[model samples]
Target: MSCKRLAIIGAGSSGLVTLKHALDRLPGWEIVCFEKGGDTVGCWGNPYPGFISTSTKFTTQFSCYRKWDCEADPASRAKREDFFRGAEYGHYLKDFSGAFGLEKNIRLHATVDRITKVEEGWKLWMGEGTEVFNHVIVCTGLAERPRKVKTHLPVLRSMDELPEGKGIVVVGGGESAADIAHRLAAPELGNRVYLSLKTGIRVSPRYHPIRGVPSDFLRNRLMLSIHRGLRNAIGQKFVEARIRHREKFERAFHANPEGHAKDEAINARRKQWDARLTAAAKDNLFNVFHTKSDEFLDDVAEGRISIIGPPKGDGFREFSEFDGEGIIEIEPDIVCPMIGYTSGLEDLTDGELRVRDFHLGCLHVRHADMFLVGFARPIIGNVPTISEMQAKLVISLIAGNLERPRDLKARHEQERERVEREFPLLNTEALLPVEMFPYCDQLASMLDILPTVRKVGLRRWWKIMRAPASTLHYLDDDYDADAVDSQRVHSPPLITGLLVLIKLIDLVYRRMRRRASSRGSVCPG
Candidate 1:
């Protein structure tokens, strides 16, 4: 095969995996990966103090690389049940590049300012001058730049600069705001936090419904199918059931002999949430982004962190009249705005960014060779694993090993519609916030790597069915199948039985529907 030149922007998890896969599939190809940051890991390259990842090691690690033994690496400060610290995950990414020999292709502290189309391929203008490549993959991540507000109350962008023993107001209803508020309000920190939510926020436990197992265990294929099948008809009820399951687990875990003293605060918060939801009937549970934090809400209940706005459909009040010195009347020592981020792809694409611009949020619809990887955010599941799958798909498309969709526009529209229906609050057009399970399976099916019952045998398939949705479940070119199986966690007896039953029913229903459709048609079921 002739040598092909490829340029990958951003050396985070997405970029490293893309480089590794490219080296493997298109050996001898000239690949250049540019990282604006001084390090290899993109997201965790520079993290704030006391930063912990929402994702667990089991689910977050790329399929090609396994074995994140925190016991061996005490610096990580993580256990089997604990989530990875930002630096620890960054270390893992660095190790990943080393393991796959991806460092040689990576250029650190190299920023690509502009990418333009050329007769041969694409032109990237970086600080080191111009470079041309046959293909360009933009893996800069979902948030190109952090969203900021016009506030003058000692705004702090990075949490690393957060001060203690002072009054703080954290803006935004997302995970960052919740986590930061929780951190600052801890008794040792001696800081009173006021969380200002623009509208309501969804909160889920880090681990609940089952102890020792991440709640993401509920995102198995069976649950995903059930959710997909039922969401359109009764999305509200489906979401309610999910909440109830989490609540049941939480109540069980927090039940204590102190006359449920801890329960008082939680119940108070629940009432506040219920009243707010009742006031705004349009903003159902489905639309809001669920913030996964174990102690954020607890802090709110215990009077450590007070909630502002998010009551009766009102958002955080604007601070239009700040004192001359940029001091607010409330006089908070610091104001942290975790509002959101903007998709920094306006220069790359024409008009506003939309789902129709890319197929599977990886391959660009207009340019066959161009791809936008790691922009899709999963509602539940690991992002690095998803990015790994995207890397495989991109290589397959470039190698002509996989066929592009004939109706690419129509497929994009369908996906957009699905995301809108399921996650209404999420803006459907721009950045992709996916359902995770079905999305991963969609990519896996395209690569013909989905772990079907026949492929892994019925026994192994059953184990997978009852376990957390690990990207490792899908067989990989690297890593032993038995080792992957050993890492997979089987749910408790009741949860396992329920999931198995649901899967069996879904299978039978699918078979019946196929049979009914094929009764008179010439096509096979």
Candidate 2:
């Protein structure tokens, strides 16, 4: 194949990985990665105050380029931590670039003002001059603009602006909101932290309820293979029980039982919050995606943070609506709205996450030369891993190693229908939410890298199925086998046995259902 010039926008985790794959796959290709920021990692380099990743270090890392624990190299052990701070993660990305010699290809403090499609290819307008590339990959992530909500209080644009030791109401029930609340409501801070939820959100603890392992450890091939409806239904019950148990445990162990009147006051306050939360989330509990947080729920139970609904009849008309009665007695000095972000991919996407337009959430249906990476939000997993998978798909397409479908529209419709059928409860509107395992598997299947039982053997396949859904498992090379396995959090034998039994029963039921349908379809003799 002839050489091609590739322009990658935004040298974040996504862009860096894309460049890595491009170097590996498209060896002779001319690649230039543009980073508008001064540093390599985009937002992570300048993370919010006291920002810690919700994802564990094991799950948040890039598939191919990641640090490993080595006895000889003590510095590599940082990768074994439970979670990564923003600065630590940024350093890791920088280290990755340096390790791969990718920095020379990356243009820091450079911006691509405009991208236009021409007969030759895509024309990128930079500050100095315009350049045309055979292929362009937009790795600009979702956090383009902070989502704003109508409120009367003094609104904080970002958590970086939040002051210590003040009455604060953090809006939104998302990860950012939860983390901010957890941090600001530290018992030592003496800050009255109140979390306002317009809609009830599902919260996943850092540790699994059953296995006491990282909750993400449960996000394996076997677990994801089960229907999302079933998995979520079971998950909802477990999470509720865990929360209840935490509440009881905290009250018994952490609280002062000597003062009966004081204890009643605390209980009443928590009960009020619980009632408000239960009412707000009444019907749509399963529909909401889980946000991983270790301290937020515990803080709420301990009376460090108060949970409330939107102010009554104050905000915009359509906002103040849920199952609960809106309004609260406490008036916050400052309000931080962590509602989410706009995609900022409007030029090509038209401010919409069209799965049809972006094939497999990477390739452009109309223009194969144009690709979008890191645009998907996984229901459970992180984005960097997903971006790596997408980058591989893009590289495969560009190299002509992967064949494009003759009918893309039909394929898109089929995929859309399949997603709707499998994940009936998902709210697929803005961020193109995907089941990470299935999505990655789809891309891996196209790449012909998906591990099969026959290829890997039954024992290895079982181990892969049981382990955390790391991207390494799909690779033919067992280079990172020890690194990945070292971090494995095994479930109890009884629980594992039960899970296998359930899976077998589900498989049998599916087979019987298919046979019955096939029999019914045949006309009687």
**Which ten-residue region of model 2 has the weakest summed lDDT?**
69-78
TM-score of each: 0.81, 0.83
Q: Which portions of model 2 show Cα errors greater than 4 Å? A: 1-3, 68-80, 187-189, 244-287, 315-323, 347-356, 417-429, 476-489, 508-525
lDDT of 2 by residue, 1-525 (tens): 156899999999999999998888887788999989888876765477566677767677776765532111223223325667658888888888988899989898888877887897888887779888998899987773446656676666553655777888777776767777888887777888877766776656565444344566666777777655456666566556555564553354332112112455655554444444543553462235566864676577677887676655544222233444553566567777776655566654344334336766777767878888998877778899899889888887888888876787678766666655545554343356677888898888888888788866786777788877778777633235555455453555655676788687767756666687688962111
In model 2, the clashing pairs are none
Model 2 residue 95 CA deviation in Å: 0.9
C-alpha lDDT of residue 416 in model 1: 61
lDDT of 1 by residue, 1-525 (tens): 157898899999888998889888886778889999788867664476667777667678887888652121223322424577647888888888888888888888888877777888888887669888998888887772445555555666644656779878777666667777888888888887887654655455465444424556545555566534433334345444545454565455441111123575576675455335323333543234566764676676678887665322112233322111231234577777776565577654444344447877887767877887888877656678889889999988877788988788788777666666766666545578776777888898988888888898887776676666677777658636766456445355766576557667768766766787678542222
